[model samples]
Target: MDSQHPPSPDSEQQTTSRKRRGIGRIGWAVLGTVFFGSLLLIGILPRLSQRSELQAAVKEASTIPSVDVITPRRAAATTNLELPGSVVPLNQTTIYARSTGYLRRWYADIGDRVRAGQLLAEIDSPDTDQQVLQAKAELAQAQANILQSRASLAKSVSDLKQARANLLIARQSWERWQVLVKQGAVPQQDADTKYATYQANLASVEAAQNTVNSDSANVKAAQASAYASQANFQRNTVLQSYKKVTAPFSGIITARNVNTGVLITAGSGNSNTSSSTSNTSLYTIAAYDTLDVNVNVPQSSSGILETGQTAQITVRELPQRVFRGKVVRTSNAIDPNTRTLLTQLEIQNSDGVLRPGMYASVKFAINRTNAPFVIPDSALVVNAGGTQVATITKDQTVHYQKVAVGRDYGTEVEITSGLTGNESLIATPTVDETEGLRVQPIAQTK
Candidate 1:
């Protein structure tokens, strides 16, 4: 606001020095601001670039899916096969009477153990006894007739010898008479009478020879009759032995159809008897020293079953017991309708714990030469292309491989034709995990 005055020299110098110092301070301040701004820009540019790179890496990692992988496991060599079977006695039979008679007494009853040739019952048949006696008498009479005929034959032979002697004498006399007639030493009538006597002697000799032949034929006929009578007697004696009922084999009697004084018919005729109408047989016997189990093996497993193969048998009634047996025989032919093989297994039942007609379950251990691989059901992928399994390649890429299934367990499946049991399989594959897609594999814990 005041008017300016002309400056002296010293004062002018002082004002000039002060203006220079203000200019220097402004220049230093501008330089310091520029240096600090450059430093800040340099630090911010590198950080921004690093942040961009980190974001890019995170985005790339998010694009690839992570998956849990498992290796396929191999199946076991032996498989257990279970089947139903029927238990039966080794030998069973229904005994019947061979002769018709009333049961007098029974030595064996139901549930009785008997040995071979043991008497079970006896029948008192008066008719059969009388028939046996009559046959014996007829045989004796026939033998007597044979003896008488033999004596008559001897007498006839002696008569034949006498006849022969007389024939020789008559022939000699006839020749002598003819010679005398020719020589005219005797009368013609006497010579003719001697010739007639010789002819009569010849006729008598022929009759005697015929009588001897007839008597010899009679002896032969009597002998033949005696032989027939003897055969009849022997047959009757055998029939009489049938009155005693005996066991043909050692066994246990399971049934008793006849008691004392019960009328029994011969053979296995009609089952309707006056005593009991329940069964046709006199007794049912079974030899249960051993037991037989019969099972029908399916065609799929028939080839693996063989004779001498071991088996385990179990019954529902005997839940705690397991019986061991072996394959004894087979039908050797397949059933057309059932498509099964009839197999028989034998088991020793010396303890008598098993009975006939019992239901049993038979288990067989079958070994497989070509065992397949087993994989979890979750690893399987079924698509329009067919059955497949998702696997991870070495390069961490998704791969879908075709697999053929064999046996299906509930939670696992058998790979029969596809897998080599060395591939890393995905535990579960999603739709996004297509073939050839890159994925990050994580090992799955069992």
Candidate 2:
């Protein structure tokens, strides 16, 4: 009641002044609170916004995968081309019998060294020997017949002379008899008788001349028969010489198919004359002084190929050794079916260490004109657009880089044309990776 009592004019004025001062203090406090709150909001709002932006940036960075990046390297000035080939000899031939006979003895066996004209085997050909003797006898008989015919020809010439003499005498007598008959120097019956005698002499001369002509024809027929017999004798003699089988050329005997007692036919190994191979080859000889390799060079490497070019040859059997050789000859034509060039390379195997028919690998040294950049094989990618590689930009975005590739090394490839050496390429890009995809590029270690 005392706190709520009505005030006198002086006291009431004092109370009102006190209440106004209190309200003023309360208003000042409210103003200070509002000002401080405004300052705090102005200071903290920008920091909160900055914190949100940093968090968003961190999230964006985590979304991208870190990838290894590589740069291209220069290729070598020279390149090696490897291909498969087979070994062969300079000359090889299968021996055959020139005359049908039974093999008597073989001086040369498999792996035996022989010289040209050396006896390789002997044949027992009793039939050929008897045939030769018969041919000689026939030749001698023909020669005797020719001599007898020549004597007849001599007689024919003598007869021809006699006939001519008789003809002259008969013609003169015929003229004489006609003259005497016309002159009536003798009796008519006597002159007629002389004319008849002259006519008979003329007929005798004609008969002798016909006999000479027949003898000449006989001589010619005998000479022709003698010539034919001589030819047969010469052929038989040549056949007899073939009983001793001699090496046509110096070489090593690679095979001996005929035993000492096997029967071999004539022309059995002549590729053109004989198709019957039922008789095995008497001998197989090969000249291995120089080893030859036959290889099919790819068509793509034809432009750089040349005769007499050097090459390197190796075989699995001779792993530690290498054979140096040169290009001997080429078919000069690309095989359309295989798309390769048939080439022959020769190597001097004087030591005889290399044998024919060995499987070999050949290497050809090639000079590269425009050596391309070498890149990791894993960097290449293929898609609908063709072969390309994934490259990273400055902003960590992947870009598709089209590239032309050449020869392939096992883990690397040659880039013929495309990027400079400065591009950062993804070493291993997944199939899902594509152009414009974000990535984190990390430098690759060697």
What TM-score should be assigned to candidate 2? 0.71
lDDT of 1 by residue, 326-354 (tens): 99999999999999999999999888889
lDDT of candidate 2 over 146-221, digit per residue (tens): 8888888788778778777876776777678778878987667766776677677677677777877888788888
Clashes of 1: 0
For each candidate, how many residue pairs have backbone atoms clashing (under 3 Å)?
A: 0, 0
> How far out, in Å, is residue 199 in model 1?
5.5
Mark the 10 consecutive residues where model 2 has the least summed lDDT: 269-278
Q: Which pairs of residues have clashing backbones in candidate 1?
A: none
Per-model lDDT: 0.88, 0.85
Candidate 1, overall lDDT?
0.88
